[model samples]
Target: MSDSLKVGLPIKYALSYRHKPTADIFFPDSTYNFAPFELVSREYFPTVTNPKGSLDSAIYTLISFEVLSVQELSLPVFVRDNLDCTRVFAPIDYVRLQGTISASGEMDTMSLKKDTQVIPLSQQPNYPLIFLFIIGLSFLGVLTFWFFGTPIKRQIKLFRFKRRYDEYLRLFQRLSRATDDKKKGLENVEKAVILWKKYVERLENKPFTTFTTKEILDNLQDNRLSDALREIDATVYGGIYSKTTASSLNILQELAESLYRKHRQVLVQST
Candidate 1:
């Protein structure tokens, strides 16, 4: 490559390695020098930022790891970062690349227009690259529920949780309306509790639903559900509760609202 055609941000053609989602090494297309990846998660959308609280113009990669000791497994981690397409491409040879008009547009491939400068893969690294060098990265690491376990096994659990939230919302809405049939309304509330217990049993990776009303209420106490759950227990075990059947419905709807709000908060923070 000639120094005259020096590389910098916004290169002509940008190329990077992509590995198979399941394993670590590059797969058979072998044509792309791809690698296999163990997807602890497929929903990851990692981002990078700068020291002054501004995001870097370039994208970067950071490897997140947790070294746990029986004494202290959780520690601060600092390490090298991931590839930056803009900066990483600057030095590479790009004979043909669909061009970029502005700073934020996608990097596309165009027909080869000029003579190509072929460089051996081994020699490409001589150029400049921006990498992440950290002292401890684990502090900012968002350990998906998968890293502690496996997504394959936990997928059903997550699905059930999402569905239960939706169902709880619907059931609560149904309960909010005034129902003259008090007995049937209580029955509906009971079923909603059943549905919640079943979902919590799965989500907590335990038999929570089987824990009886008292036990379930105890477990959910810290989760901002104590009052509502107590009311639910009163309805189930006692002949009746202080709140009317419609009020019980209100409690159910309110509990669902609180949980869904929390779940959304978690998802937003994660993204």
Candidate 2:
């Protein structure tokens, strides 16, 4: 062998003979034949005996060795019969078999036979794309709720307020139509005024139901509202019925409508 040896590489050498001689061959174990290598394993296959006793179908041997150092190497193998007879001749002896190991370690390649097929692998899922799609859908849902939720809430509040205002106006009209009978008309007007005060207190978040005429005017800063309530109070409490009682009730109705319109306008502008 001419090239330098390398450590930890398995080098294999195999030999087969055509003769069916009654003998066993052994690989050399001395350092002279394998100086830089260590014997790893050996294998022998069953002899294929021919029915016609042909020498060509006989014994086969395989051996493996691992390179252990960097040094010159020479391998000599011998064949001997069971009767201690040795064959040092050309076809039986292999004394000149030699080589070196200098290449990097690599595994042997395997080639498939003709018409063999390989299975295809399945594709992997794209996780990033799926995550982005879910995020986009969530953002769209939040945006849609934010855009339409406010206007719907405001419209519902306005509808409820209109229904409540209509109820107050209907009661005022009922009182105004009863003005022909003095005691009954005064009672009806007093009830209507009390209902109006309670409704305004709820709508404006103030204590109008507990306020006197002067207190109501002072808290609201509206002279028209005060004058309208005073006229109704005089007719009911003082028993001073006037011909303009219906018009006084109309003035209270107008004042309630004005307050409703102002509140509605503020709600609309905010939305």
Candidate 3:
């Protein structure tokens, strides 16, 4: 027997007899009066024996029992042989077993203590890291705009201005070629001047579209712009028959080119 017995474990009990038995072996009724164990299996083995030329038969009984509960167990065992018509006390008088029901190993059932406490758990988001990541992205965006955004914007503005300037130059050339016809030359000059004013209004964010020719010249404070506009307006409105010379139109073109260059310089410096 082990020092400690685990519940549900089987314990074997065996007994051998010198003479053949008439009936199967069994525990007495008293054994079940307070049964705390189950009988799992029972077996009997018979053998012929020879002692000093005398032959006899012997029987051995083996019983397997499983412990059912935790308690101190004591049992008294008695056996009887039918051939002798006699009752005898078993060689083992008393069987004692003791153990606990509490879990001990992987195979044992789990037991809970009354005082055990359970703590609640929760997951929290890392707000600081998220905020830092957002700030880092914002700073990167600003730096990118500072380094590359300005140059791209300037290039686009210059391209649009150059296209408009080319259109004005072609119109001026047509006006100069129409010098032989006074009315036709004046009409082309009027169109070129109007187109130039509209482009300047857009580029400078000015009121050139609403301004009179005199007002435009005053706003610009350029003597060359004033003279050129006056000559074109005289031919268009005053019905003047005087032809516009190529030299006079070239002066106006130079003035427009100079103004475009000035505005472009301002854009580049601001970036």
Candidate 4:
């Protein structure tokens, strides 16, 4: 036994015995408890046999973390029998513990000084995690645009179509109501005609704005359109406002509504 052992340091202990038994014996494995100390390693020598007896020996490496001044330990070996195993214990051993301490001896309590100052540490941002989150968000955005871009565009176009059509209807109807006034009626007619041309051009993606009434009839190839434009043109050119002017405006409005529905259906089906 050592006079004193430092904490966490390893020490070796050995045991040996001789017996005439025929059965084999096994030294302590990891399952064995070395209470006051912890096991580090184990080394065993083969049995030596003579006619008199068989000798077996084993060494255990151990360490202790306990603060107890005196620690005791004992190891055991198992002897196999026909039915079960029996444990044979070695004699007890003792070791002394030595704690770490400064050689300066005790301090004078009255002379001791203390500083109470504290420095605060600034919090740091998790830049890597922030960057990863931004990248993930950007990737998700790109994926959404890639998968749904066409549908989004179709929806925007449909919305614009409806909005523009509504605006045209509101303006044309307002001007049509004002056509009863002979003072502004002729001017209103010209404005209404221009408005219709622009609306139809946008709706059908045609050049109706530049087209003359004859050109419009030639392109549309519809007798109703020809008749309606003839009435509207009579009021526009001859400076006349009659019941036919109002009917012609209604006819133009119906044509525009029909064109709007046709184009809207095409967009819906594509979506």
Q: Which candidate has the top score in lDDT? A: 4
Lowest-scoring 10 consecutive residues by lDDT in candidate 4? 99-108
Candidate 1 has a TM-score of: 0.32
Q: Which candidate has the top score in TM-score?
A: 4
Candidate 4 has an lDDT of 0.86
Q: Give one digit per residue, the lDDT tens place, for model 4 in 120-190.
A: 89999999999999999999999998999999889998999899999999999999889988689889988
Clashes of 1: 21
Per-model lDDT: 0.44, 0.63, 0.60, 0.86
Rate residue 226 of model 2 by lDDT: 64
TM-score of each: 0.32, 0.45, 0.41, 0.51
Going through the candidates in the order shown, the clash numbers are 21, 0, 0, 0
lDDT of 1 by residue, 32-91 (tens): 211111112111222333343322121221111222111111111112235421212223
C-alpha RMSD by candidate, in order: 28.1, 22.8, 26.4, 15.1
| Ranking of candidates on TM-score, top first | 4, 2, 3, 1
Q: Name the lDDT of candidate 1.
A: 0.44
Off by over 4 Å in 1: 1-164, 175-183, 202-206, 222-227, 241-245
Cα TM-score of candidate 4: 0.51
How well is each residue in 1-271 modelled by candidate 3, as lDDT tens digits?
3334444565544444443333433443423443444555554444445453322222222222445334433433333466643444344323444555346656523574475688777988899999999999999989988889978888888888788878877876776677556447667656666766776787678989799877777778666776677777776688663645455566667777787889878877776
